[model samples]
Target: MAQLQTAVSMIYPPRCTTCGDLVESDFGLCGPCWRETAFLGGAICDACGVPLTSGGKDGVFHCDTCMQDPPPWVQGRAAVIYRGNGRKLVLALKHGDRQELARPAGVWMANMVRNLVSKDTLVVPVPLHWSRLLRRRYNQSALLGAEVAKNLGVSFCPDALLRRVRTPSLEGLSHEARMVALEKAITPHPKRGHRLDGKPILLVDDVMTSGATLKACTNACFDAGSGPVRILTLARAVKEA
Candidate 1:
């Protein structure tokens, strides 16, 4: 049966989830499309995990924004920079319902966090408002979080956090406006059943844009007795304001 399915799929090859081009490989992305993504390189910014250029003087590596007001999360890691094919891939997984992309994306993120986090860590996804979830059919962050937890052998808590507000689309907003929009957008689940008390948490999200969303979610996690919060994402948009 498996071989027959493979033969049928080969006859009608599915398009690459990222580029929408005919996929030649079973892995879902065309070779050229896959080769275009540049995963985070060495010496990344500790705050947001954007790749850093070599410094001349002090041997320090810091993105310009991280040098200013630092982010609230203890550590952040991203599988790739959000540009070119990377951005397209993330959008497909998120809005296009090509969720199969989550498997590899989540594994890549989990491997990045394996040494940094432990098996005991709990996985929490940045929550989406109910209205948004209803429109989207599924929460991409939750799907990614589930895969990451499965790969890391950690507990996955999908409802550990909840969103309190349904903010407008964040595109074209200033950094301050984005922060304000996310402020108080997240809160702890009221059921009190999924206890995060004294447990470390790894927050999963599809992309790390301005990080306002992650910061708000992490603050709520800390308030609910979760330990230091670390973040992992499929992509990290360059911080250019």
Candidate 2:
């Protein structure tokens, strides 16, 4: 299949996800777009994975935001800093029906958190409300989580988390309101036999903004017997300093 994809790419070169420029590989951005994407690296929050300007003491760093109010998950990692092109690629995947970008996004996500994955790990995705799922015709996180699990050779449970409640859109809500709205929105899949059973879980998502949604999802996983939940998103929104 990879060979076939290569052949197809040779015939019809794959274009960038954010821009139409021809890139060397599939589901990627051109050099300029790549540069424009602020890939997160270097020192970051030990809990939430926000890049830090100054190196921390004793090799343990927690951003001020996380220090004040930590996330429910054990740790987190994001592939790109959500701003210009990162935002574009994420929007393309979320609302533009560019499902093809999931492969590369998953690849980047897998690479970002390969150390967190193991044979016993359970890869799950943040659930979408049925209404939104029906309207979107796909769950981008499920696509990303499946590909990530395949790349890491771990168990992928697309329905591990279920969005039982369909709430209003989270956009434009205050942080506190967003937190309240996301409460009880996501819960573990009620399938009787499938339990996390102390297994580590990698929660996948397309993007993380205030992380309220991911927090709700993480709490659900913990309540379902999942252990040491870690997060990985394609992009994370950060305001300018």
Q: Pick the candidate with the highest TM-score.
A: 2
lDDT of 2 by residue, 33-85 (tens): 88888998888887777788785889767889888898888889998988898
TM-score, cand. 1: 0.87
Give one clash count per candidate, in the order shown.
0, 0
Off by over 4 Å in 2: 1-7
Q: Name the lDDT of candidate 1.
A: 0.84
lDDT of 1 by residue, 1-241 (tens): 9899898888877887666788765546677877888678678876688887765246446677877877777788998889997888789888888888888788888988888888789999988899999999889999999999999999999989999899888888887898899888888998852577788989999998888788888889888888788999999998554
lDDT of each: 0.84, 0.86
RMSD of 1: 2.8
> Which pairs of residues have clashing backbones in candidate 2?
none
- Angstrom error at residue 144, model 1: 0.8
Off by over 4 Å in 1: 1-16, 20-25, 56-60, 192-194, 239-241
